[model samples]
Target: MKTRSKIEDEYWGALERLKIGKTKVVDTKSTRFRITKDAVGREAGRGKGYVRYERYPLLCEAIADAEVARKKNGPVTPSSNAKIEQQKALKQKAISDYNQLKQAYDMLMTEYLNVVRRNFELETGLAEVKNVKIIRMPSVR
Candidate 1:
């Protein structure tokens, strides 16, 4: 079986190819979870993310993986929808954590790249400096 990190990497890489770029699934304690977007990254809360009974692709995948892992581990829980749902939620929590980590990692890399690019441009007199003088200081990012 693939490691959880491997699965998460594949999922994040797939998400990176999107025109929208990023997405998240949040399962709130309350009914319905909705997706929120901004000029920055995407956001979704558990239970508060989608409408009632709405199914999301990533969320489904997480649930399925959780179920499989649970089954493979041997101590099988009762085959009830409620039990399944609870397990799925637990699994989804792990996925959500990894998703947030991936998003933060992406954001950090992007910021670092931009900082490097900006520093390079300033040092080489490529970026517009107008009246401002940029000193070649050590990189902080």
Candidate 2:
């Protein structure tokens, strides 16, 4: 299985490609969309169905930004233009907030791991153990 870091790297890379016009977002009949490469129109990410925001939030943000840019570049009324600008700002803020929360979560996880390691050392009387493995069990719903 791919590590979380690897998955996040792939998502961020795809989002960057989409932002720079290296990839394009294609909309389906349902309210779903796919990100495809510009060169050969190949799908960038995994899965056959429409991209889900819950799975790839950054990619979805990129797609929304691309759509807003497309609309702004084309013929648009003043009121609609203002709305688009508002939406863009809101999206940026949301991304910023999400990033901050993610960072906090990462820090908390690191602290938790350190505490666990210390506890293990104190209980087992092991000195300076460099490796600690954690096995997580599935939680009951």
Candidate 3:
């Protein structure tokens, strides 16, 4: 099995080729985790920007080596299953957040249109602004 540092080197090198910037790898007995650098590096032989695919293989190989190591040394607890669960929670939260934003935006847009329509009615000498209805979507679909 490859050493942890060797695996990390391979992964970072692959990322470099792929223009994925830099990453820092932390290794425990059972699993390896990579922390990507905040800043991305520029692409080679190009004008600007970074590329992700260039270094994918390098990262994959490093991860594969880590998995092999994990098989030999058992699983890592705090970082493995916990991370999966955390990701799932984050995904659900994101969906909920998106729904909330969409609802707020819809309401605001409707109110803006209603205001405009009320202004138009006043300009055209109409009475009362009681025709607007904001309907909530049915919960069961």
- Of candidate 2, the 10-residue stretch with the lowest lDDT total is 34-43
Q: When superposed on Cα atoms, how far off is each prediction in RMSD?
A: 22.4, 22.1, 15.3
- Alpha-carbon lDDT, every model: 0.49, 0.59, 0.51
Candidate 2 regions with alpha-carbon error over 4 angstroms: 1-78, 126-141
- Per-residue lDDT tens digits for candidate 3, residues 1-141, read 744454345445544543332333322221343322212221122222232445344554544564455456664456788899999999999999999999999999999999999977775553344664544568996
Worst 10 residues of 3 by lDDT: 38-47
- For each candidate in turn, the TM-score is 0.30, 0.35, 0.34
**1 against 3, candidate with superior lDDT:** 3
User: lDDT at 44 for candidate 3?
Assistant: 23
lDDT score, candidate 1, position 64: 51
lDDT of 1 by residue, 1-141 (tens): 633454344443433322233434323222332222211113322233232224334544544554455347544446799788988999999999999999999999999999999978767684365666665669898
* Top lDDT hit: 2
User: What is the alpha-carbon lDDT for the whole of candidate 1?
Assistant: 0.49
Model 1 CA lDDT for position 84: 88
Candidate 1, backbone clash total? 15
